[model samples]
Target: MRDNGAIAVFGATGQQGGAVVDALLARRARVRALVRTPESDRAQALAARGVELAAVRIDDPASTVAALEAVDAFYFMTPEADNLEEVEEEVRVGAALVDAAAAARVPHVVFNSVFGADRFTGVPHHDSKHRIEEHLKKSGLRATMVRPAAFMENFATVMAPSLEDGTIVVRMPLPDDVPLKMVSIKDIGRVAAALLLGTADVPGGAVEVVGDEPTGPRIAAAFGAHAGLPSRYEALPLSVLRNDLDEAMFRQFAESSESPADLAAVKAVEPDVLDLAGWIRSTGWTAPADRARS
Candidate 1:
């Protein structure tokens, strides 16, 4: 069991924050989740699970400060929107939250940043997280910024329709040998909870989170195994992707395939972290018929 601490979880109703809250509860940590709607289904479920519900909008500084006043740590993640202005707004909100947490004298902050956030420039939403990380470091607060690689859950997003149609589309141009790291949301939560509950000695640290490093072919194989179809990854050119895809989405995917960072660092610390094969197996999906297509 991990030590209990009063941690304020932002975006608790969403994916990353929801995972964090679940992980915290599993370890018996005291969690205070900030939800905009206390009566919403997600919020009600969290309340039922013993998380303290604090009403606060991510953009409201006073509400954020009040929520952080009594918490020892914070788990921060902003929502992603379709527009650039919304992207900028997320950055502004993150900055505001950081300021409030610092003002409240919170000892630790855990930010869910994206892989290559420190260097990527084309995608505004993805890049905004890096700016927040910089602000947290300069604020003199003990911070652990986790830059997670592309999520395996992304397949569900892109291929959900294809799953219904029995087909899959490969949008971003990734070479057969280009390696990409994929992490599960569940593992992200587990690692994050461990970090929050552990000693707060390592400040100003940035950790890259990943479960598996797989190539396009490997990914196709995994998908095939899970979906029971002859799935194959077709390499689409960047020009074609740009014409058919959202600019921001295409840019984010394009840059991720080229990131050189190793994900073994996080697994080294958390040896029980789930791998891609284990993740697929856990989902209880059947393997495809033609493994050769992958």
Candidate 2:
């Protein structure tokens, strides 16, 4: 069993934070999940699982500081929004939490950052995390930033509807040979839990989390195989997506950055980290033939 300590988890209702809370609990760590609504069904579920609940305004750093007084460790994850301004606000709040943790003398901090954040300055969200990272480093806090690769859940997010209709539109402007580093959000939580529980440490002071690296067509094939649909990836220019802000950013990523993640290293830390195929099966997203017929 992992050592016991009170760990404050931000974004507890969301995917990443929820996974972290579950992982921490599995290792018998005391978890204090910060939620906007303690009455929320998800929050209630976490409480039922023996997770302590703390209400705090995630956008307010001062509030986080007050709530984190009882926690020995902190896991901070910025919530994503459709608006760029909201994202910027979250970044500021994340940095504040880091400073707050420092003041509180939290022993360890596990920050969920994006892969290529330190290297790619063009991606606004990625750069924001890097700025927070700089602040954490300057604070002299014992922190481990987990820079996760592109989420495999994203394929479902952008392509689910299109895949249901048969063709998976690949908006990424990358060649077939160029691999996209992808990891399951659950795997991200697993890695973070290991760090927080003292089960593992990033030798280089940071972890680039990746479960698998697959090309666009390969992702399409996996989805097709799981869904039992005759789906194919149709690589199109940014114009096809009508220059959507998110798609444009992804295009910039394809042009400027390379998705380099050490999957072997990640696997060594958490052997249960799911590969693409394993994730596909676990999610149970495969539509039955009868459902597809409709």
Candidate 3:
């Protein structure tokens, strides 16, 4: 077990931070969550669970510094875009947080980055995370960076249209044989929380984390089994999908699917990490009836 100390978690209401908070709490670590609106239900629930809630806007340097006071470690995540200044806002918030971490002299920092952040620049949001990673490395802070692969939960959003109609649509253009790794948001939290609470001797390093590498057809098969339907996976050309989505964003997804990181290397270090099938079974998704009833 790791020593119990106060840790400040930014974006505590969101997926990544929420997972970290749960993990820390499970390990009996004192957690301080920074939120923009403390009265929000999510914030209230966190407080009820024994999390110390601090009201602060990530973009405000003073507020961030105040929240970071006396924190042993920090978890940083940024907001996503909805087609407007998404990338720029993420970069700004990230830079501000790092600056505050430095000023507060926080000893340990962990950041959630996207897959292919170091190489793929087709999308601004992913690239924004890369910039933040670079900044954190040069800031002279002991940091651990986790670059997660495409989230399994993304199917709920990206493939929702098809799910609603009892069909599956492949929006990004990629070869049928091209394989991409996917992970559950829950697993991301589990691994992150374990790292935060364990004295695993990881400092000043980055890990490419993935759960499973499955091709488009394989993913469709998984979803089909869960949904209890004969779903079809069709590879839509990027040019066709571009008519409805941002071409730049679509291009980024295309590139990432084609050039995924080595899962063997990721699993080698984190041997206890969950694979796709294991994640599905643990999350109760294999049986659609159970998932819906829950």
Candidate 2 residue 186 C-alpha distance from true site, Å: 0.7
Of candidate 3, the 10-residue stretch with the lowest lDDT total is: 285-294
- Candidate 3 shows a clash count of 0
lDDT of 3 by residue, 109-216 (tens): 888887766655756667788889999989998888877877777665665425435453444455576666777776677666656655443433777778787777
Off by over 4 Å in 3: 1-3, 161-173, 201-204, 225-231, 239-250, 253-260, 268-272, 286-294
Clashing pairs in 2: none
Query: Per-prediction RMSD in angstroms?
Result: 4.2, 3.1, 4.3
- Tell me the spans in candidate 2 whose CA falls farther than 4 Å from its real position: 1-3, 58-62, 161-175, 227-230, 240-245, 255-259, 288-294
lDDT of each candidate versus the true structure: 0.74, 0.77, 0.73
Clashes of each: 2, 0, 0
In candidate 1, what are the lDDT values of residues 19-83, reduced to their tens digit? Answer: 88898898888999988899999999999999999998766788878888867788888777466
